[model samples]
Target: MNSSSPIASLTKHLWSMMYYFVRTYIWLSLIMGISITFLMAHLVFWYLDSEQLERFVSSASQTSQQLHSNLVTIFTHSNNTCSEQNLITMREDLWRAPLIKDVVHIQDGRIICSASWGNLEAGLVLPKPTIVWPERGLQHWRAVKDPIKGDIQVNMVSDGAVAVLIVPDNAYASIPSNYPNTGFILSTEDNRYVFHASGPMAPENVLTQSGSSWRLLLTQQCNTSSKALECVTAYNAAPGLFGKGLWFISVVGVLSLAISALLHSSILFVIHQKKSLKRALRRAIATQEISVLFQPKVCLTSGRTIGIETLARWHDKHFGHISPDIFVAIAEKNGLMPQLSRLVIEKALYQASSLLKTDSNLHLSINLSMSDMSDPSLLSFINDHCSGHRIPAHQLIFEITENSASGFEGIESSVARFTSCGYQISLDDFGTGYANLSWLSKIKATEIKVDRSFTQMIGDQDPYNRNTLSAIFQLLKDLNISTVFEGIETQEQAEYILRHIPHATGQGWLFAKAMPIQEVARFINTPNSSIQHNADAAR
Candidate 1:
């Protein structure tokens, strides 16, 4: 009887725990299921809305580029500036360019003549523009009230020769009838000026307000061209999971509650299944998942793109974006550096072959690790690849880090061999690692890249840091070695480099970020845009 009683008590205890567990699980599942269903519905609507916005922005960008191209054509054909014949030509262009409402001749910050208003007696003095892009030689005004047409405002863009006028509302008048709550706004890259806006949301509200009810996607449009602007497309959230009936919601809620019991176990399984870095990297190399990007180097005095440095980039489905430093270190440790370097070189040269052929002066730079310099096969591989691509050896600059140069034995001879083969060598990241000055004297480098650590010290109040920078700059100048000031991210840094090293080139985000191959082509296409010329002229 005592043994039976103990068994009964143990069974009751187990039953109670199971009952509580089941009850809790059921409640949690019900709650999570409802939440998930609502989230899924919202995602569906958001996806649809984003697609619509993407199409709209793309169309607008094409239209803007077309208009700018036509305007450039008008400027090219009309040799005379603001003359009677030029005015006639402008009027004719206005008729041909459907997007352009009118054409105005601007000189010395004043409207001298126009297609609509033939000529002004003394020229109507104009106010300052809302935004200016010195690099592209472009300026724009968001709202200009017409003197003759009472209360009508027009948008204007000029290249210091002729201005093209556009009716702001006409640009965004194609909003679909179904998307009643959809809103659009076009602004400068810096968001300083609103070029156009439409729908229920005002430009001011769209820019200033941050609300979950409105989902906004901002895209930088026409950034690589003269016609540069940013587009913002908004969609107001639909109420209650896009109007799913109560019955549907209830059913989904019940099903989710039932399935919630297995969710924890499934998540655990997924977590354990994630691949290690080595395994993933090996797979990436095998699948050719690595990509190459280009960072432009601009002449400090002219702000013209002079060269581009190739950068290896990788994105794994599970790992997202991996930094080069991490991947490179892992590759070296795993005896995969050679393979990785070859992959990067192959892709970069292939992608840049056309651009290199077009511009002989535009050099393509590739970075090499210490191991790469040590490998005998590397030089031959690169030479063969260059020959295949028809790229000149002199057009390729091999960039080696300071550590790589100092750590590697017989690096000088390696560099000399490369130079003898007509390739230029650059000592990159000049100020970091071991602080050795012997490598500078030993290696015959064509160029030296001042590290960003030094660039960051431009505005330092400490006299010691300032003097160190001065000495470094003076040393490079004394060596007569071509120098590239890396990480110049601000106007101050650029100005400082310009003041100290007038002949030096710069590479950084202030001019442009590292972009894809296509953007590089577009950026190099316009040599006369003169970012620094306008700045100098303004001064």
Candidate 2:
């Protein structure tokens, strides 16, 4: 069967579809894995943070109790009066304590003494000053506004006396505020009386002390829940869950990528082995079990077949139809490129012999390799074959791939000799490599085939140059060098090339993909091949 057989194309299309499906699944799995990892990380961090806050509240509770014990010892030992020498000593002792503001004593519901103010003179009425506070425990906490300094005092009272602690705002130094956007709200468990209230909107999450009357709230330092959770988990989370989640995710991703790559490689290996590419290639060449196909290159202005590019095809027993590139690669690796090239050239010349005789203007294009060119007897071999087939050298244009044309040192001289002997040389796949302008200046071929990349850009505005191929064609015209646009797969691509370079030739699926040699006459029978400007220029 020919390389252009419908079955071969259908197989490639099916493989492409399957590849897309598998690629999409792989991407989805990758993304899902990452998301799950991060979510789990945040959850872990939040739990740790919550636990840390509970411990902080517990510390606050212990501190409150210690203050309670100190107040109890001081009140009962001084005969409950300001004049006691011990009472004066107690006041002196606590006066400079950081947590204490003042200590006051009451006798029979009358204001009797204040530690800092001494005895009340002229019988200042006490009137049982209001003490409404949260009932966290048997002890009482009262908040009273200070008039002059405009600060508040929180009083911790026992059965006998009241101990005034410094204002919460001034005393917050005892609690840590090290975390970002996160602070603690120091208040009673019920929140009825706030010792140091975390400002409004401070705590978005809360935790209570396990064995105490205090509540600790995590404030709004964290904007998102993830950040908040991370902050909480990081509170006392020194040397904690910081890098554990990332490490787990990295291992998962690396293992997945490795496994996926291995799986794909194994599948491709199976495909390659089942087809037995090396063996099939040898069999195909030995028995000439291959078909020759030709894709017509039409003149843009005339819409007539000016030339046809030769292609070879082989149908495998197991893999159905394989791509030409695969077999060609196998041939090169096995050191059979010379034999393969010679066989294809001979077949193309023989199969198209009658067509060449019928149309004097038509030429056939055949790709040549570096090995074929480097062979000293290659020119003679081709001439002998052409002479036997009665085909003129001018009618067969040898196509040299850009890469093959560049590396060979004496290639330019050899190619020049071929042209001098009535044969034409073409630089295939032009503008797709480093050899475009550099090799063009050095080697100088009769024709340049603009590679598919440039053809694909036809009728499209150049992202960089803007003028793009339009400018290129104008330069070609000035240089009087013929141009052939390759890989014009759509009618729009065809129209774009024709409209811009009407004198040039084009070969692509639009005009005619490669077809069996037998189908050549059928296409050529109609001189006007119904090519029109109907297709929009490709953008």
Q: Each candidate's TM vs. the true structure?
A: 0.48, 0.55
In model 2, which runs have C-alpha deviations exceeding 4 angstroms? 1-275, 404-408, 532-539
TM-score of 1: 0.48
Compose the digit string of candidate 1's lDDT tens values, residues 214-315.
345333443444455554434343433443467866776666655665664454455444337777888888788999999999988877788999999999
- How many backbone clashes are present in model 1? 1
Which residue pairs collide, candidate 1?
29-257
Give candidate 2's TM-score.
0.55
Worst 10 residues of 1 by lDDT: 232-241
CA error at residue 242 for candidate 1, angstroms? 64
User: Which has the greatest TM-score?
Assistant: 2
Candidate 2 RMSD computed on C-alpha atoms after optimal superposition onto the true structure: 16.3
